[model samples]
Target: EEALRGLKMAMKADSPAKDTAAIVIEPVLGEGGFYAAPASFLKEIRKICDENGILMIADEVQSGFGRTGKMFAVEHSGVEPDIMTMAKSMADGMPISAIVGTDTVMDSSGPNSLGGTYTGSPTACAAALAVFDVFKEEDILGKSQRLGDKLRKRFDQWQEQFPHVDNVRNLGPMAAIELVTDKTSKEPRADFAAAVTKKAKENGLILLSCGMYGNTIRFLMPVTIEDNILEEGLAIVEQALKEIG
Candidate 1:
């Protein structure tokens, strides 16, 4: 809901409204509570961009490579963007951001205009291609769906255990838990949120705190993490919540 609202706000921004090149967004708001934009919202955006002759770009940096239970989060909507960028977790975190777009949009420059990137050399490309091979061999995409199911189930268990937790919302592996002051404010327990995240880090758990107000802790567990390892991490999070008592 708010995700689409924010995009609308961005589109309405003065500079963008005056003269814009493109509209870029993560189909699933990764760090922003891992919220998945509804299909209707995506469809509307695509329609609007098409009508306005504006480019619609999907930033699949974090939600790419089976992270969202699919090879890409945008695939969930089946709506292709005019432009898209992807990188993270593609080459085992190797730095590479690719802009996939139509020739018309990308080949506007002349020769020698786009030839100064030695970062993703043959070695990195080979490594990245190899990762894709593994995805095919091991069916990483399927694993992502299964992993997300397990993760959500465990997260729900934790929410039940910690009644202060209002609920869990996620898109595949990307997930976030919203904490309430007492299950009533439904308005984020800011202090407790901080304490829990701090305690989790202290207990050897890496935590990413997010949400517009910084009152939510996001779990960006690697999709490659074994089931047991994810459970262990969950235990750490649970313990952290307990300590904040």
Candidate 2:
């Protein structure tokens, strides 16, 4: 995203900050919006960070591990992050988080510095590993790609049919639609967004809404969801949108 790119440039410009630089970002800006940053932007930022000795940090809490058609969203760009943070769905809601980094960066931190009381406790790790196995065995990553594609097509259909829908986008299972009264002005229609989300929940689609302006509906389908179930959820959304429109 431009935020990371701009931060990198700002660091280079600031003599003091330049020496202490760490570029943190979400490859797929989730709550800010369910939009995936262009891969080209990611590549440029990676090159800039490398040349400037800055570390690129990807917040994959919302876009990692079978969520973005890749094991990790970083695979979309093929540019490795110096440090990647994760965990929202690592183990069936068994709260966990991690900071994966290069050996050098990891070694920089001392021993016994980051583990939690539950960190790496056998049960969680074993369960997470089992989830990983299921993901691979069931081709969950491929399903994510198809799910995103289906979501985009459905979103586009809504956008074309409904004038109030300003934009529709998909990033793996993270798809969203924005409502606007003035398409040219792109003024957020928060009322419409909230009302539809409420209706969708009533109609059986447990959607979430969180954007800078609170005018977007976000969907995060479980990667392991069956096609019939996924379609059922989307159908609920479509019905809700129809009623709201």
Which candidate leads the pack in lDDT? 2
**Model 1 CA deviation exceeding 4 Å by range:** 1-18, 115-120
Per-residue accuracy of model 2 over 110-134 as CA lDDT, tens digit each: 8778776568578777777887888
Model 1 CA lDDT for position 28: 80
Please provide, for model 1 over 1-245, each residue's C-alpha lDDT reduced to its tens digit, 9 standing for 90 to 100.
68567766877775464477677878888667778888888888888788777888999988888888888899899898988877777787765666677888778768866643635487777778988999999888888888888878877887777766766877788788877766655777778788888888888888877777677888777777887888788888888877765
Whole-model Cα lDDT per candidate? 0.79, 0.81
TM-scores across all candidates? 0.89, 0.90
Model 1 vs. true fold: TM: 0.89
Poorest lDDT segment (10 consecutive residues) of candidate 1 = 112-121
Which residue pairs collide, candidate 1? none
Q: Candidate 1 — what's its lDDT?
A: 0.79
